[model samples]
Target: MQPRRLALANQKGGAGKTATTLGLASAIAARGGDVLVVDIDQQGNATKGTGIVATEDLVTTADLMSRAETGALERAIIPTPWDGVDLVPSDISLGNIESDGSNDLVFRLDMAFEGVDLSAYDAVLFDCPPSLGKVLFSALIAADGVIAVTEPTIDSVEGVQNLITTLEGVRRRPNPRLVLDKIVIGRRRNTGEHIAREAELRNAYGDTVARTMIPELAARQDAHSERKKIHDFRGGRAVALQVAYDDLLDELNLTSSRVQEKGA
Candidate 1:
């Protein structure tokens, strides 16, 4: 059984896409399930957050995207400090891939995983760049589902709608199997604006929006800075974040048994 591959995507920067990806990975691992995180963002935020400092000689997502080769992704997979989690890291050089003129560039990421078995893990997550570019398209082609992560700001609805348009395009052509699995509201606050936006989103999307909303808490940033998982970080309301991510994991049905049954 192949693991369910999902892309965590939102076109707007600072929308907490990377944070959600890492948080979910931590949650899955803490539940005794394995997860592989593919960091396609040039910023390498996910890589750094997982306690990895990629030096120059390491194989990265850039290498996987540069060409269409079978089993290349296996080489890029490296162990992270977190248990039951592996990573395909990225760096600033990945930015150059957007400019390449190759007509097959968007399909390379899918090709890179050919002949590689991913059944050992519960899920594979693609941490996409905060843009609707070639990299994002590639991830969509490779993934089975997408989790749209967004904030409760005024413009967040527009951002999610735009990503939905992109997903429609991908489904029409490149990946018919790709599905928009859920819309996760992240970095939420108790302010009136946030409350209104959240209500608007639920009204617009209805049950497509996830029931679990991740709150904006200082412990998230603090854990990222300390290179620790939210479940492992103790102090300053970290327990809230841990509970949120755990709820999200269950809400998304990302547990090993559920994912495997889906794959089967």
Candidate 2:
């Protein structure tokens, strides 16, 4: 079965891409859906966030990208400490691999995920690098749709537009079926300024900006340091997050799964 891949991308940094990716992947897994997180960033923040240690001993994306056959890549897939989730972790070697002129980089990642059976997983989350590079293109080709995370600010909004243009350009060629299904405005607040920004984004991009606005909660940030997901403890954070993710999935008519209870 073709796995529905989602990329949490933004041209600007600190748009909560990593946080969104981790939360969604973990949430999907918590709901009993098997999930895989591909850490495409050279920084390996997502890898670190998931507590994947990288001291050069482990096989990583670097090895996979350079290999002729993805046998090594599939071998590198690690069942992370996270339940119902597996990872093709990133590492420092990723810095040496440039997407600028790689030979067929787009199809490269696409093939990496091919052999594996994605039927059990409800989704595959690609934590993309913060640039328009081979990794993003590759993820786009593999993904059925993408969710661009934008903050409630103008600079971030501008970056979001540029990202869309870049994706549009890619779709014109290698990823003709690629659909940037929705733009997510995360960390929304109740201030008048926030409302205006949201309105502006809606006016600018129309309905592509999803109706689900993830509220900024202190606990969401707190969960990070604990190496825990916001979905774990119930309350405002979990309810709001669940609503946003479920709304996005509903918009796409996608199915959700239930994972065994944590530590069961």
Candidate 3:
């Protein structure tokens, strides 16, 4: 099966983008699928959280950006601590990649992921930056789909409208095949505001809003503090996250071999 490349994004902070990326990647890989997580966030939370922080310099995304000349992207693909998973870890250099690889900008990521065809891997997840920056655009242009993460707030929804506008503009010219797989709602609460927001979102975006709701669980924060996924940690908090994200994964179709290949 052809790999599904998802640029998981949300310009706003605290939208559970990082947590979702880490949790889903691990959960999906644990199901006997080969996974490659491409992190383009300068903060490198995904890199640290996934235990690839020590693999800096040698095969980091920054090193690939430095030598995009040879059209060697595989050099950046690093084997993570997990057997079924790998990482295209990122650092601060991800921000400078666009300007650095100016002439080769359009095909930079495509060129980097050249040889090791994604068909072999079950999924390719791009942990995007928190802004509509260079790294975010590059991933959007290169990926098969974008999993837009959103919080239960009017402000975040407003940002999605703007993001969609920007994406629409890009689709008209640059990446013609870009598709939004689904917009995952993050940090949900049973509060009145959150309840109202969810209804508004469904009415606003219709089928784009996914059925799963990632509840506002403390486990997400607790897991982050330890640099471990919620599923990998112990205690009741960990169990809560597993239940919440399990519903999410089921909605995302990651629990099965079936996957919707965007831009197919």
The lDDT values for all models are 0.92, 0.74, 0.74
Give lDDT: candidate 1, residue 20.
95
Rank the candidate models, highest TM-score first: 1, 3, 2
Per-residue lDDT for 91 in model 2?
Answer: 75
Summing lDDT over every window of 10 consecutive residues in candidate 1, give the lowest-scoring window.
255-264
TM-score versus the correct structure, for each prediction: 0.96, 0.87, 0.88
Clashing residue pairs, candidate 3? 73-112
The segments of candidate 3 whose C-alpha lies over 4 angstroms from its true place after superposition are: 54-56, 66-71, 98-101, 258-264
- Model 2 gets an lDDT of 0.74
Better of 1 and 2 by TM-score: 1
Residue pairs clashing in model 2 are 31-258, 31-259, 32-258, 32-259
Instruction: Report how far off residue 133 is in candidate 3 (Å).
Output: 1.8
Cα lDDT of model 1 by residue, 1-264, tens digit? 788899999998889998999999999888878899999999999999999998887899999999889889989999999998899999999999999989999999999999899988888999999899999999999999999999999776689999999999999997999999999999999999999999999999899899999999999999999999888999999889999999999888878485455553
